[model samples]
Target: MNIIVTRPKEDGSPLKEKLETMGHRVILMPLLRIVPRPRAFIRKLPYQAIVITSANGIRALSGHTELKSIRMLTVGPQSMKAAKEAGFLKVEAHGDLVGLATHIRKTLNLTAGP
Candidate 1:
């Protein structure tokens, strides 16, 4: 089988290696690049939980210590792990954005302000 991995290089490497070991030909064609932006002073915002849809978002937010204490809702396992590694103590992994939103809607009241 021939597999084309469109994830970023760092993310695709392990999967490519695994697929190769499984007797499949893998091609890495990164679809996106993560570029860190200049540090910005983040103000304290009223939110129940921080929602992240991508591992890149976790990486981008890693330098912002203000969000460390807030709960995180990530879209996938990899993003969840990344959030944890980035010092998020409270993290939840959902299969997709809709799932995350549904979980949040059910778990929290909008009137409570996160």
Candidate 2:
């Protein structure tokens, strides 16, 4: 079967390869382009934990090895894997925004520091 993947190049390329391995014809038609902001501009805030929703966030936070000590909550498996690869000691994976919010509320002391 022929499949058209419309994800970004970074994400679509992997899916294309996987499909080819499965003997499916995958045409990668990347519709989105990621323009990463300056990594230096990203700084750690005074928060108890860090919440990341995208794998790109990991790339953006590159070189901040000290941040690996902070607890991290990611939106999906990909984000979780990225966090782990980035050497985050404490990482939680959630499926969606609501789940992530619930986890934060249950785990974090909201009345405390930001």
Candidate 3:
């Protein structure tokens, strides 16, 4: 079977390897690209925690020193793994966006989303 994996170029490689190993032809086209914002250091400002929706975001934000102090919140298991690999010590996987938002809201005692 032919399977198409739509993810960022950095992340698609691993999925391609897995699908090819499973006997499927995989086509990889990155759906997104990471271009650091102009004021990359702005994210360094203090916040209650860090919210990561994608492994790419984790990778993108890894270079910032401020992330080291914030609690890591990931939307999925894969993202959590990425967060850890990117050097986040206190990683938490909340399943999905809504779940992460709920978890963050409950954990931080706030009514806002993660």
Candidate 4:
């Protein structure tokens, strides 16, 4: 099958090898790029938790002292995997944003307009 792997180019390379080994043709079209935040920039946030939807977010936040204390809510298995690999210990797998938002609303006990 002609499979299109849309992960970032660097990450996509590994998947491509695995897919090729499985006899599937892989196309690498990265839909996003990961740019890390400056180390100095991380010193300014007062966040309680980190919300990450992409693996790029994991790469961006890696090795920052500020994030060490913040819990993480990540979308899908891949992002969760990346976040964990990037040293996040307190991570929540939220599946997708819509589901995450629903979970957040419930967890926070937020109600819709009356």
Error of 1 at 18 (Å): 3.1
Deviation in Å, model 4, residue 70 alpha carbon: 0.8
Candidate 3 positional error at 86, Å: 1.8
CA shift of 5, model 2, Å: 1.6
For residues 1-114, write the lDDT of model 3, one tens digit per residue: 998888877889998999999999999988877775653655334466878888767877888766666798889999988888888888889988899989976888464433
Candidate number with the higher TM-score (1 or 4): 1
Q: Which pairs of residues collide in candidate 2?
A: 47-114
List residue ranges in candidate 2 displaced over 4 A.
21-23, 42-45
Q: In candidate 1, which residue pairs get closer than 3 Å at backbone N, Cα or C atoms, i.e. clash?
A: 48-114
Kindly list the per-residue Cα lDDT of model 4 for residues 48-67, writing each as its tens digit.
56778877778878878568
- Compared with the true structure, all predictions reach lDDT values of 0.87, 0.85, 0.80, 0.78
Looking at model 4, residue 67 earns an lDDT score of 81
TM-score for candidate 3: 0.79
Best by TM-score: 1
> Where does candidate 1 stray beyond 4 Å?
111-114
Q: How do the predictions measure up, each by TM-score?
A: 0.84, 0.79, 0.79, 0.71
TM-score of 4: 0.71
Clashing pairs in 3: none
Q: 35-78, model 2: which lDDT tens digit per residue?
A: 87665744657778989988778777756787888888998888
Q: Candidate 4 overall Cα lDDT vs. reference?
A: 0.78
